[model samples]
Target: MTTLPIYQLDAFTSHLFAGNPAAVVPLEQWLPDETMQLIALENNLSETAFFVPVENGDADFHIRWFTPTVEVPLCGHATLASAFTIFNQLGFAGDEIRLQSKSGILTARRDGEAIVLNFPVQPIVPGTASDAILAALSQEKPQEVFKVVSRDTDYVLVYESDKTVRDMKPDMSALGALADRGVIVTAPSDSDDCDMVSRYFLPALGINEDPVTGYMHCVVAPYWAGKTGKASLIGYQASARGGFIECTVEGERVHLKGRAVLYMKGEIYLP
Candidate 1:
C-alpha cells in the first residue's frame, strides 16, 4: 500500500466553504499521468494540484494541475493552494516559492495575510462570438468580445453592468457543445469596493462555474486596467461562493493577491 498526504484549501478566501476549493497532493517524484488524472477525478474538485521538488536553479518545484476530466496547462487557484501548503504546512523557510509549470515559471510570495502570485498576462485581441455562443448567452448581449491570445482557448465577454454578469444564466449544453472555448463574463462593478465583477464557465472542462478564478484574472486584469487606466484594481468573482482578488498589471506580468484557508488534511491511500 502507498499513502500520500493531501490537503484541501479554499483559495482566494480567508474562510472555509468559500472561494475555489482545490486539492493539493505533494509528490516525492512524478506519478503516472493516468494516476494523477484518476486522483483528480477521485477528489472531484474543480482542480487538483500535484507538485514535486526540483533542484533546478530556476524553480523550487515543478507543478501540474488537473480537472476531474482532463489535465490543464495552468491553474491559478490550485497553484496558490500549493504555495499555501508549502509555506504553512511543509515548513518551507522561504517567503517565496517558485513553481515551474507548462505555462512557465510562476512565483508565489508571502504578503502579510495574502499570497501574491506573479503570472504572465494573457494578451487579448478583438474577437467575435459564434452564433452558438450568442444563443447560449441570450439573456444579455455582450457589448464586446475578445479572445485570449494563447494556445488555451478563452473568450472574454464584456457586459454593461455587474448585475447582468451576476444574473446571467447561459445555456450550459450549448456552451459545452463548443468544447474548445471557456467563457468569461465581466462588467464594471456596481459596488464601490470593487472595480469589476466576473463569472467563469467552462463546462467542457467539467466546471460549469468556477467560484473564484485566479487564472481568469490574468486575462481580465489587463483588459480592465486598459479600460479604467488603473494599474491596480480590485475584482470580485460573484459566484455562489464569492471571492475577491487584488490585481496589479506590470509590464508583461500581473500580480494576483488573495487569501486562502485550509479546509481539510488527510491521506490518500493507493495500492
Candidate 2:
C-alpha cells in the first residue's frame, strides 16, 4: 500500500469555486506514468500535477501535469497550484521555486498575495484554420487567425470585440476530433482594468473549457502587447468560473501573476 498527500486549489482566483481547479500530489519519488495518469483521471480536474524532489542544482523539483485522459507537456494553473502547496503547505524555505518540466525550466515566486510564474513566451505566426473549424467555433468571422509555435500547435482566433469571444459556442464534437490541437479565442477587453479577454477549449484533451488558463496568456499577452504597444497587460478569462491574470511581456519571456486559494487537503491511498 502507498499513501500520498493531495491538495486541490483554485488557481488564478482569490476565492474558491472561481478559478481553474487543479489537484496537486506531492511525491518523494517519481511514480509510474500509468499510475499518475490514473490519478489524474480520478481527480477529473482540468489538470493534476505531481512533483518529486530533485537533488539537481538547477531545480528544486521535477514536475509533470496530466489531464483526465492524457499527460500534458506543460500546464500553467496546475503549476501555480503546485507552487502554492510547496510555499504554503510544504514549508519550502525559498523565495523562488524552480521546477524542471518537459517544457524546460519553469520558476515561481511569491508576490504579496499572488504567485508569479515566469514562463517562456509561446510565439505566434500567421496561420490559417480550416473553415470547418472556424464555423464550429462561432457565428462571427474572426479578424485574424494565427498558430501558436509550440508543442501543442494551438490556433488563436482574434475577434473584433470581447463580446464576440464571450458569445462563442464551439462544437465540442468537431473540436474533439482534432486531438492534437487546442483553440484560443480572444479580443480586446471592454473593461478598463483588463486589457484583453479570452477563452480556451481543448475537448480532445478532455477539457471542453478551461476556466482560467495561465499558459494561454503566454501567447495572448504577447500578441496583445504587440498590438496595443504595452508590455504589461491584464487578461480576463471569461469562463463560467472566471479569473484574472496580470501578464508582463519581456523579450522571450512572460510573467504571469495570479492568486490561488486552497480548496481541499486530503490523503490518497493506492495499492
Candidate 3:
C-alpha cells in the first residue's frame, strides 16, 4: 500500500475552524484525474489541493485545485491553505511560494503571520440580465441591474439594506435555470467588524452557497474598490457560517489578506 500525506488548513482566518477549511495534498507526481477526483470527494471539503515540483525554481511549484464536484479554474482559500501547508507543515523555508495553476500563475506570501494572495482582478461592467436570473431572488432587484456582462458573474445587485440581503431566500431551481455561472448579491455592510457584507450563490454551478470564497473576490474586490475609491477593503461573507477576507486591488491584480490554521494531517492509502 502507498500512503500519501494530506494536510488540512483553514484559510481566511487566523485560528482553526474560523475560515474556510481546505485539504492539501503534496504529491511527487500527478495522479490520474479520476484518482484526484476520488481524493477530493473523500476529503469532502469544498476544495482539495495537489502540488508537484515545478521546472524552473526550487522555491516554486505547480498546483491544481478541485472542488468535491468539479475542478474550477481558480480557487482562493484553497490556494492559501496550500501555501500554508507548504510553508509551516512541509517545513519549506520561504517568505513566499509561487505556483503555476489552471487560472494561470499565482503567488501566496507570508505577511507577518498572515498570508496575502495575489490573483488577477476581474471586474464587472454594466449590462442587462435575463429575467431568469432576476426572478430567482425574492428581493427587489437593484435599479442598476440593467448593466454589463460583469465578466462571468451575473450582476452586482446592490441592495437597499442589509436586512433584505440577509433575509433573501433564492428560488434555487429558478436561479439555476436562470444562470449559466451564478449570481452574487451584495450590500453595503452595516457591520462594524467588516467594510462590506455579501453572499454568493451558484445554483448553476452546483454549489448553493459557499462559506468563505476567495475566488469570488476576483470580481468583488475590484467592483467594490472602485465604488469606495479605496484600494484596500475588508469583506465579510454573510453565510450563517460567516468568514472574512481583507481585499486590495493592485493594478490588474487583487491581493487577498487573511490567516490560515492547520486542522488535520494524515494520509490517503492507494493500492
Candidate 4:
C-alpha cells in the first residue's frame, strides 16, 4: 500500500471545533487528479489541501484545494492550515511560506501567534440578483448584490444587518441549482468587536454552509473597508462553529490573520 501522511486541522480559530476543518496532505510529487478528488471525497471536509515542494524557486510549495465535489481556484483557511503544517509539523526553516496556486503565488507569514495570509483582493462589482439566488437564500431582500469574477463566479448578497446574515436558512437544493460556485452573505456587524459579519454557502461545491471562510473575506474586507474608511478591520463569521478574522486591505492585496489548531494526524493508505 502507498501510504501518505494526513492532518486535520481547525483553521481560523485556536479552539478545537470552532473553525473550519481542513485536511492537509504533503506529497513529494503530484498525484493523479482523480486520485486527489477521491481523497478529498473521503476526507469530506470543507477543503483538502495538497502540496508539493517547489524546486529552488520563490515559492516553497505548489498547492491545490479540493472540496468533495470539485476543485476550487483559491481557499484561505486551508492555505493558512497548510502553512501551519509546514511551519509547526514539517519544520520549515523560513518565516515566510509561499505557495504557487491556480490563483497565483500566495504568501503566509507569522504575526505574533497568528498567521497572516497575503491574497489577491477579489473586487466586487454591481450585479443583478437572479430569482434562483433569491429562492435559494429565502431571506429578506438583499440591499444589493455583487459579482466576484474569479475562476468561477460567486454571488455576494449584502443584507441590512448582521442578524439577517446570521438568521439565514438557505435552501441547499435550490442553491445547488444556481449557475455559480457559491453565495456569500454579509452585513454590517452590530457588535463592537467587528466591522462586518458573514456566512458562506456553496451547496454546489458540497458545502451547505462553511464556517470561517477566508476566501469570502478576501472580497468582504475591501467592500467593508471602502464603506467604513478603514484599512484594517475585524470580521466575524456567524456560523455555528464561529471564527474571527483580522482583515487589512492594502492596495490590491488582502491580508487575513487568524489562528489554527491541529485536530488529528493519521496516514492514508492507497495503492
Output the number of the lDDT-best candidate: 2
Model 3 earns a TM-score of: 0.90
**Which window of 10 residues has the lowest lDDT sum in candidate 4?**
148-157
Q: Over 4 Å off in model 1, which ranges?
A: none
lDDT of 4 by residue, 204-266 (tens): 788889998889999899999999999999999999999999999999999999999999999
lDDT of 3 at 225: 85
Clash count, predicted structure 2: 0
Ranking by lDDT: 2, 1, 4, 3
Clashing residue pairs in candidate 3 are 126-147, 126-148, 127-147, 127-148
What CA RMSD would you report for each candidate? Answer: 1.1, 1.1, 2.3, 1.1
**How much is 67 displaced in model 2, in angstroms?**
0.6
Residue-level lDDT tens digits of model 1 in 1-271: 9999999999999999999999999999989999999999999999999999997679999999999999888788999999999999999999999999999999999999899999999888888888778778666689999888883468899999899998888788889888475899999998999999999998877888989998899989999999999999999999999999999999889999998999999999999
**Poorest lDDT segment (10 consecutive residues) of candidate 1:** 146-155
C-alpha local distance difference test of each model: 0.92, 0.93, 0.80, 0.91
Q: Which wins on TM-score, candidate 2 or candidate 3? A: 2
Stretches of model 3 off by over 4 angstroms after superposition:
57-59, 146-155
Comparing candidate 3 with candidate 4, which one achieves the higher TM-score?
Answer: 4
